[model samples]
Target: MAEARQLREYVPAEVPESAAPATIEDGDLTGGATDHTVWSCAGNLTAVRSVRARVRDFLARMGHSETVLDDAELAVSELATNALLHSRSGQSGGVMTLFIRSDGTRLRVAVADQGERAGEGGHSREDGDDFGRGKLIVDSCATRSGEYWSEATHVAWFEIEDPRPGLSLADTAL
Candidate 1:
């Protein structure tokens, strides 16, 4: 399993003291260079890879710098893969959705799935083998405000401030 850096340890400063929060209200929202796009896929694990690939292609086509595209795509993969592996619950119509957004100053990636994973706590790939706690990676890279939720539906997300000329991950690494 790939070692995920610890979230608390890699805290970035850009994360607000309260951690910025947002949502994907519906399925019809259109994303722009400074906005976001939401893509939903079925619970099958295969869909995770597909979502990652599509997101990467989309970012590349959008002309995002390689660094930004890779970070966003990695975050997408970790969240989507986790949704398929743990939150599916074998439900007939389970779906996993990815919300990608960039505010020019930062990028936010969110992954939501059909079932809740609250009681199980967050699982880590280091927890004895088959799965690694991908959230740790997300958290480490995300601003201090990044978070995860396991409500009736499972959702995990993270945010990274855009590392422009005057900004650095360290500056954002609260």
Candidate 2:
């Protein structure tokens, strides 16, 4: 078995006040000229709803279509659920973090949990299992998925291309 990776210590830098509300406090990981939003919460079941709401609000501010918004929200929810249910982050006093970044063309979502490995010792499911279908939903909606371990945390991310390019908030008439 492969040894688990450890998470590196990070200190969030202060962004300028003029920065966009969604600006990344941490370093940019999405490699795009776009704003980013981040959230950190206790690793518990309730964090799922909080993360989903934040994702919806962020996408709305970015003028994403209703379909895209729904897809992003669902994907984030699944990621958070997995962190809370399968990772060490779900333990008491553990933490989970979420990041969202978007350029005009694509949206990326990442969730990080303080886990030794990606879904380490997670619940096993048989072929006919009704639960544990979150990954399927994520794969169906996202154009791409990525996973990596940093320090003691496992990060899982997904990206979705914009359905309607060049549509700004003014264009949406919102």
TM-score of each predicted structure versus truth:
0.59, 0.69
- Please give, for residues 1-174, the per-residue lDDT of candidate 1 as tens digits: 011122212223122333345532222223544323333344457776777787667655555556666677777778777666676522345555555555455555666565654366655656787665575666665563244443345456665555462333465567
lDDT of each: 0.53, 0.66
Q: How well does model 1 score by local distance difference test?
A: 0.53
TM-score of 2: 0.69
For candidate 2, the C-alpha RMSD (Å) to the true structure equals 9.1
lDDT of 2 at 166: 46
lDDT of 2: 0.66
Per-residue lDDT of candidate 2, residues 1-174 (tens digit):
011122213212122234323423344334544433333444458879888998888777776777788888888889988887777767665667677777656788878777753445545576455667788899888877656664566777777888685465576776
Q: List the candidate 2 regions with Cα displacement exceeding 4 Å.
A: 1-43, 116-120, 127-131, 165-174
